[model samples]
Structure formats: C-alpha cells, structure tokens
Target: MNIVVCIKQVPDSTQVKVDPKTGTLIRAGVPSILNPYDHYALERALEIKAKTGAKITVLSMGPAQAIAVIRLALALGADRGILLSDRAFAGSDTWATSYALAQAIKKIGPADLIICGQMAIDGDTAQTGPGIAYHLDIPQITFCTEVDSDGTKVLVKKLIDGGHQMMEASLPALITTTMPHDYKAKYPSFLAAFHAQDKQTETWTAADVNADLAKLGLEGSPTRVGRIFPPPAREKGEIYSGSPAELATKIVEILKKENLIK
Candidate 1:
C-alpha cells in the first residue's frame, strides 16, 4: 500500500518569541520541532506499516529548513521524503498551502491513504486537511483519534462532540488525526539519524508541482492578518476567609451588590 503522510515543522511553542515590529513569529532564534500532531500521525502510519508493510512517504511544504522534519520522519521509518519548497510558496495561507500540497500530492503518484494532523499548533486552523481533500476531490475523515486500514479499506475512530464514532472510507482517501493525550512521539537513535541522511528526498518547487502562479502565495490567500497581538492579561480572583455562616452572608451580600442575586 502506498501511504502518504503530511507533516510540518513548527516553532517549539515553549521557546516561541514574537517580533514586536512585524507581529510575526521570530523563527530565527526559536527552536523548531516537528508538529506534535504530525508526529503522531506519522507514528500511526508506522504502526499500520508494521502489519501491512505499507510504504510510507512523508511530505511537507516549507522553506529548505523544513527538511529537518522530513529527515526525522525517515529516521523513524518512512520509506521516502518529499519536500516542497520554493520562493513562490512563501507567505502562503491555508488556502494556498492546500492548493500547493494537492498539486504536489498529484505528482507523488497514487496514494492509498493520506494522513495529516487535525490542526497545526501555530495556526490552530483545522482547514488544510479538508482543503487538500477538496482539491484532490477525494473523501476525507477528520478528527480521528485512531486509524487502521487494510490495503483496500480504511477505518477510523472519529471524535465528535459528546462522543466518538467509527467510520470507514475506501482507498485513496484522506484522514486527519487528533492524537490521544498519552501519545508519545518517537525520535531516532543516533545511528539511525545518521543513516537517515542517505534516504532519498525529492525537493520540488512551486513550478515543479505545477501550482498556478496566481494561486501560489500571498496573492492567492483571501484572508489577511489585520493585526496580531497577545491576549489581555487575566485578572486576579478575590478571596474571602471567615466562618461558614459569615462567609455565606458575605457571599450573599456580594452577589446582591453585583445584582447577581436578590
């Protein structure tokens, strides 16, 4: 089975810094890590491969630096890596991103199953995966907590409000994952990391993927960032200490004073 997983390189949230002047992430000094949800998606693919012997190809789109995440994928067990990077792809929003990736996936040949994280940590927009499915004109399942597939059919445990649901889709479909809380990401051994360098990675440009220039970058993005700012600081809570009866009276008075109770 040909399995494709889309992963991303994201700023390590703990060390993220924002540029005051531009209202942009300061990625230069901040450390980069594989998006944790992507890691879990990749791990899920590996788990399936363990039994089905699927050939996993890890694909990503970003600057040249994003290859780190691809190499990490190879070191973990993906058979190959495909990096889509070029000047034209810079400053792309989710719409343009999904367009470019859909084009690239077309170039990667037929895929039995495609996996992606439910949302990116930095953007928190869960739109890209569905966008890919739309661009590819394929069926998709989102917010899956667990996934399994035979060579022909894919099954998933999807998370929904108040409960979970089990669903199945045919081959050549896409699924986005929301990993379990106890999920742990895998890192390669030193030797495996070194050998991962030898694994084949094909780098493609916006043109190589046949992405329309009109739909490649900021020009293609309909959404604009009006302004970026941090959230307001939280206020401190009040405290009351006294006997139970006194505290009850105090609470009642405070509530009445606020017109919350009478």
Candidate 2:
C-alpha cells in the first residue's frame, strides 16, 4: 500500500506576535516546528505502515525552509519525502493550495491513501483536506483520531459532536485527523535522525506537477484576508453582593436596562 501523509512547518504560536501596524504575523526571531496536528497525522500513518508494511511518503508545500518538517517525518519512519516548493505557489489560499497538492499527488503515482491534519495552526482553516479530496474526486473522512488499514480499505475513529464515529473508506481515499487531547508527539532518536539524512527527498515545482497556472497561487485564490488583529481584551465581569431577593431584582433591573429583557 502506498500512503501519502501531508505535513507542514509552522511558526510556534506561543512565540509569535502580530504586527499591529501591518496586520500581519511578525515572523522575525520566531521559531518554527512541525504543525502539531500534522505531526499526529504522520504518526498515525507510521502506525498503519507498521501494521500493513505500507510505503509512506510525506508531502508538503511551502518555502524551501519547509523541508525541515519533511525530513522530520522521514526520521519518524516515512519512507520518503516530497516538497512542493515554487514561487508560483506563493500567496495560495486553501483552495489553490489544495489544487497544487492534488496535482503533486498525481505525479507521485497511485496512492492507496492520503492523510492530512484537520487543519494547520497558522491558518486554522480545516478546508484543504476536503478540497484535495474534491480535486481528486475521492471519498474522505475528516476529524478522525485513529486510523487503521488493511491495504484495501481504511477504518477510522472520527470525532463528532459529543462522541466518536467509527467509519470505513475504501482504498484511494483521504482522511484528515485530529489528535486526542492526551496525545503526545514523538521524536526520532539521534541515530534515526542521523540516518534520515540519507533518505530520498525531492523538491517539486509547479511545472513539475503540471499544474495549471490559472489554478495556482494568488490568482486562483478566491478568498482574501482583509486584516488580522488580536481580539480586544475581555471586560471584567460586574460583581453583585446582596440577598437572594435583592439579587434577583438587581439582575432583572440590569437586564432590562441593558435591553436584554422586555
């Protein structure tokens, strides 16, 4: 079975700050790490590989620096890594990004399964996975916390409103995973990391993927970010101290004065 895991490198949110004047992220001096959700997804793929002996290929679309996360995936047991990097892919929104990745997957040959994180931390837009599924015209299961496969079909435990949903999808399908609350990510040993440097890793461009120029980058993006800013600080709650009856009256008066009640 050939399985492709999509991963990303993202800035450490805790160390990131917004440029108030520019309404953009201040990336200078900020450290980057593999997106935690994607890390979990890679781990899930590795587990499936252990069970089925599936060949795992990690894929990412970002700047050349993004190869760090792909190499990390290799160290954790992915067979190979593919990085889709190009100037044409710059300023791509979720839709365009999905288009580019879908094209790359085709170039990678037939894949039995594709795994992705529920969302990237920097964007928090859980749309790319579904978009890729759409572009590939394949079935998809999202928000899964666990995944297992037998080389023909995939069984997953999906998170829903208040509980989990067990689901199954045939081969050549896509899945986006969400890590469990208690989940702890894994790192490779020094030896493993050292050996990962010898693994096969390739850098592909838009031209290599045969992507339609009209369907990539900012030109293909339908959504535009107006601006980004931190939410206003929350106001302190008003304190009330009185007898039960007095408190009831006070609440009624306040609600009425605030036009919250008739």
Please tell me which predicted candidate would have the highest lDDT against the true structure. 2
Model 1 stretches with alpha carbons more than 4 Å out: 233-262
TM-score of each: 0.89, 0.88
Query: Which window of 10 residues has the lowest lDDT sum in candidate 1?
Result: 224-233
lDDT of 2 at 18: 85
Q: Rate the local accuracy (lDDT) of all candidates.
A: 0.92, 0.94
**Tens digit of lDDT per residue, candidate 2, span 15-94?**
76789888877767789999999999999999988988999999999999999998999999999899999999988999
- Alpha-carbon lDDT of model 2: 0.94
RMSD of each: 2.5, 3.4
lDDT of 2 at 66: 91
Model 2 alpha-carbon drift over 4 Å, by segment:
233-262
Q: After superposition, how far is residue 58 of candidate 1 from its true place, in Å?
A: 0.7
